[model samples]
Every structure is written in structure tokens, then in C-alpha cells.
Target: MAIEIKNTQENFWSSDFGKEYTDRNSRDTRDWDKFYLDTYGVTKTTINEKILGNLPKDAKILEVGCNTGMQLVGLQKMGFTNLYGVELQPYAVEQAKKYTQNINIIQGSGFELPFKDNYFDLVCTNGVLIHIAPENHHGFMSEIVRCSKKYITGFEYFIEGDVESVNYRGNEGFLWKADFCSIYKKTFPNLDVIQKDFYPYITDKNLIDCMFLLEKK
Candidate 1:
């Protein structure tokens, strides 16, 4: 499916896929948090040990689509301060606020974040963009980059090739194209991709996701 471009501010807030993915993701969190915890010991410990170990502590961090604030807890455990997050789902926002007393949790769209320009030392998005409409991906990335002062980190799931497809998570969003990373690099000329590696998530044996670290030049 070719991605349709949407420009309305309301669509940004109340996206169809966002609502669907939130519903599914929240259900997964409620049902699978314990199972995941039992299998992997400590909140995001496995992922953090693998992908997030190199990030700078004490930097202002903003996590987009921070469901249940698991990432916040992980960052705090790693000695990170000045943490903030934005979650579109009301339940997720409330759950995230309950998880972290110091972190700021805002309910808004990733494309239209409620913050001043260059507000964060790092902007991070984990498993969020796969649900966004493809045509709007560039605009959404622009918004994220605009908010970041020094760096941007992302955990993204993308498929290679011209055929468009939605991911296992139920959403009409963009799948990864092999050249999408090139597109991102071109969009942010000053943001140099420092590290990126493709990793297979054990949860789904067939899928491939990558963790990326980008620093401003």
C-alpha cells in the first residue's frame, strides 16, 4: 500500500493506527510484562545491555511512545536524569506517570510534540515509527530531529524492498525500505549516524529490527 499523506493536526493526535497499536500494545504490556520479566530479569535489562549501553548518562532524554515507562526505569537504573516521555494513549500515559515520579509524561503525537525547539540532548523512539504512515515519516523524523540538541536514538523495524507492508503489530504504517536509512541521513545533514546494527528480535524469529545511534555533527 502506498502511504497517504495526512496534514491535519487532529490526525496527528488521533491516528487510526496509533489507537489500534496502543490498544494492542497496552494489552500486551498488561498480559506479558510478567512473562517477559520472568524470562529476561529486570526491566529492559536485556535490551539496555545490548543496544543502550553506549548512551550518555545525565543527558536530557525524551522517549517517544514510551509505553508504561519501562525505558525510563531502565535509564534511571543506569543513572540517567532529566528524563521525559510522550505517550498518545491515556492508559499508557497514566501507567508511565505511575512508574516514574520525576519524569515528565505528555500525551501528544510524535509529529506534533509539545516542546520548544532543541529541547532535548537526545530524542529516542523505540518501536514507534512502524505504525506511522509512510508519507509522513519524513515530517515526523524532522520533528524528532528538531527537538534533539545533540543526538537521536531509534529502535526501528523495517522491511527491505519496494513492496509496502504493515508489521506484526496491527497498524497501517510504513515498513522499512533498505534505503530508508539513507533517506534519514539526507534529511538531517548534520546528524551523523555513529552506530547501527541489524538484530533479530527473539520474540519473532522471522523479523529483523535494528538499533541506531546518531550524533549531531
Candidate 2:
């Protein structure tokens, strides 16, 4: 029988498996300071200079799996006023609220977003989509695109073709890699790739990811 992926994901992220992450991040052990994505080295400065330039200071942005709200905090500091985040894990949501400001943190799943259509100027995920099962990708993608008025972004592990399973802390099928760019391009014909960049993870040299920025036509 197929595993209930949502239940499995909820269990993994709400417990110590997820708490440890938020805890570590709070203590400065996780380097998610500023608009720079920790461990992976993707930064707002770098991204603005390279791919997406001239982001409005007051644009509405939402992060799909904003674990500890670090990225949201970073964006606020960078001058973005209206910011929002949705996190499935309760502990993470609590921690994010405790730490960040000017951002609405909601406890919800990506498959069924609670926001209205074209609500956010930019909608994104940082290393979050990899955890979703392939079958559920269509569901999540549709909601992400629907909520975003102009831009959709994914900074995630790159898989050229098929879904590849990742072994995480003795867990199997919890993580998978896919070419997010290809998937987005194929899914929405009106969306055009604005920028694409790749780099290796600092924590683990073997792990690599691609940052994709797509503009809705």
C-alpha cells in the first residue's frame, strides 16, 4: 500500500526531527542570517544581482515552507513590507512567530494553500519542495502558481529527470530530487524562466541545488 505522505511528513516535521532544525537555527548554529540562505549559499544580494533584479521594497511575498521564518525575516530586513509564510509543523510555526515580525505565519500544508488567487506578488520555497511526493506535486504547484500574481521561485535540489529517493537520517522516501525548472516550465506554459542558478551545499559538498525564478505571463 502507498504511504500517506502528508501524515508521514507531518510526523517528521512536527517531532524532534523538525524541532531540532528550528532549535538549531535559533541558536545561530544554522547560519540563516540575512537574506542569504544558510548552508546552501543562496542570498538575496546574489539573486538580485544575478537573476531577479529590482524587487519592489513593498511587494507581497509568501514562503510555502518557511520553517523558522528566517527567510521571511531576511526579506523584511531587505525592505519587503508585506510578507507571509505557511509551515506544516506546529513547533516550527511557533518558533517562527516567536522570532520574526511583519510576516503572517500560518500552519497549513502546501497541497491545500489557504490563500486567495493572485494574492502574493512572489511565492517561493527554499529546499521545501523536495520533501513532497511526486504525485502531490501537481496539487502543490497549482496552488503556488494560483497564489502568486507575478513570480514563482524554487531553490531546491536538482534532479535532471526521474524522481530520486534520498536517505535522510535513516529515513527512506522522505526526500526526492527533481528538476523544478523543467517541471514548472512544463506545468505552466505562460510561465517563462527568468533565471536559473546552481551551487553545492556548504554543509555537504555532495548535495547541490538549483534556484529557479519563473515569471507568470
**Local error of candidate 1 at residue 43 (angstroms):** 8.3
Which TM-score value belongs to model 1?
0.75
Expressed as tens digits, the lDDT of each residue in 53-119 for candidate 2 is 5788788889998987876776676667888998887788888767787789988888778889999
Point out where model 2 deviates above 4 Å: 1-7, 27-30, 33-45
Q: Which one wins on TM-score?
A: 2
Show the colliding residue pairs in model 2: none
Worst 10 residues of 1 by lDDT: 1-10
Model 1 global lDDT (CA atoms, 0 to 1): 0.67
Which parts of model 1 are misplaced by more than 4 Å? 1-46, 49-54, 167-180
Query: Candidate 1 residues 1-217, lDDT tens each?
Result: 2123245432543555545555564433334446445433333445555556766777889998787777676677777878999876665676565567788887766767788999999888877765565677788889888898988877676566652565544333344433345557877788787777666545666666666778877
